[model samples]
Target: MSSKFLFAALGLGFMLASCGNQKSEYDRFYEQDYKDSVSEAVANAPEPAPGTRTPSAPAQQQPAQEVHPGSKLIAGSDCTACHSNQQKLVGPAYVEVAAKYEENDKNREYLIGKILEGGAGVWGQVPMPPHPNLNKDDAGKMVDYILSLNN
Candidate 1:
């Protein structure tokens, strides 16, 4: 009986030890496989045509996106999490907003107020959360950025 118990205990200990080492061995195998696949893909990739930019080309060779002061302010805030310039997410796209309203002082002021105070129903049922932290001038900048998308 004692021998049987000892054998069972040793078997369990060995099983647990093997299980622990198995994960690390599996991880090493997976990492090697991933590296091999990436290397193969790079090797198989076609070379860039003459006059075209290569993958290793400097960023300065690429055309830069124009940035506005209002865009800079919006990028620093939580606006991007919900809104995009072209595609709609939680709210309408900036372009959509711009399209709906004409560029003018009254509309600009109204949008600034909406940004600061928050509102719903104009676009849909989802209410735009208020931005109490942002001042009127900053909100106006954001509004300007959105409206500029029309042009």
Candidate 2:
């Protein structure tokens, strides 16, 4: 048994030793050439002037107001089964959710996904159910509605 184990160990070691120390395809960033290229790109990148928005930044936060399209969609959907604008039911209140998240398109995109796909832990142990039937446009409208309540 010991002889067989030793043979297996030696064979494994030989296989590993024969393999070169080349980086895997997924580890491209770890390569020295890739690192140098990334550094060069960053150094050459243009800077934004004062008060200008960066390309990667989200759109400006809109003033808190009623998003009517989103409101109507929410009224039609099953969201009212657990959520409301002012207070908690089976899930966190819309106001609480509004307060907890930032008011921006990125946050809106995230909440849209959360609304359609469902998520847990942002509020508590209660899990949200997935709305597979919901369209992204309507989901986004729901997000818009939620963000409008951020007062």
Candidate 3:
């Protein structure tokens, strides 16, 4: 083959190979579109404001003094084993629990029973075994601390 013809063929081969390896503009556009869809879905979802309860039910304001006493008991107990203030550990974070229950007084009572009698499937797949050792007062305190996280 002539040198010029050979060089032209080599250049064409290189161009084809590069085009084959590169992502198509359509592929890039779709990937970006998927990401934007997910971001928009999340942004449009309702998010509770900090220190405000979820709007499932209207929450009556409890006196801070009454909540403080129970919170102290919760801090002294074993509720901290599975629950933390900020993040999920063995179980969902106390902050998350508080956020879910904050709107309903009935939720507080129901959670108190769960604490004493242990339950499953409330937060996730993990089962939170009952803590029968905790008395009513202590359990009430833990619930208070859980609620206090909203503050």
Candidate 4:
């Protein structure tokens, strides 16, 4: 082949090779089966009988209370980046955290500390980065807001 034709072919080959490695959005979404598994587990797990109370429903259905003002600061500052009330993002959903820490004051403090100083292995292998910008009071307020998600 002529020199110009050979270079053009090589460049086209390189472009095609790069494009082959790129995942489609659907592929990317499907690759994380863990998310689907977690969601399924939450959905399929047996629920309390009609008369019995369940933790998940009560927390969401309860009337709103005076939410901590500082909680919004924390949420806006960083928490909402990965967490939401209904779905998993980077971290477990807020309801999951609320269920775990509900009725336990000490767990609240521990989690607040975790927020200030990031740690891994608690929720999963994923390490939650420390938020040095968050002071104790603000962190506490965020924790309280998280707990309130149950209500």
Q: Judging by TM-score against the true structure, name the best candidate.
A: 1
- Give the alpha carbon lDDT tens digit for every residue of 1-151 in model 1: 2344444455445444555464676766655555555556555656554334344543432244666779889878988778877778788999999999999999998999999999999989999999999999999999998998898
Colliding pairs, model 4: 59-150
lDDT computed for candidate 2: 0.72
* Per-residue lDDT over 1-151 for candidate 4, one digit per residue giving the tens place of the 0 to 100 score: 2344444455445444545566777655544444454445555656454333344644653344643674556546867667666667788887898887864778878988999999999789988899998898888878877787786
Kindly report which residue pairs in candidate 1 clash with one another. none
TM-score for each of the candidates = 0.60, 0.54, 0.50, 0.53
- Model 3 Cα shift for residue 126 (angstroms): 1.0
Q: Write the per-residue lDDT of candidate 3 for residues 16-88, one digit (tens) a residue.
A: 5555456788756655555555555555655554433344422342455654666556546765566656768
Off by over 4 Å in 1: 1-66
Ranking by lDDT: 1, 2, 4, 3
Q: List the residue pairs that clash in candidate 2.
A: none
Candidate 4 positional error at 106, Å: 0.9
- Ranked candidates (TM-score, high to low): 1, 2, 4, 3
Each model's backbone clash number = 0, 0, 2, 1
Over 4 Å off, model 4 = 1-67
lDDT of each: 0.76, 0.72, 0.66, 0.68
RMSD of each: 15.8, 19.8, 17.5, 17.2
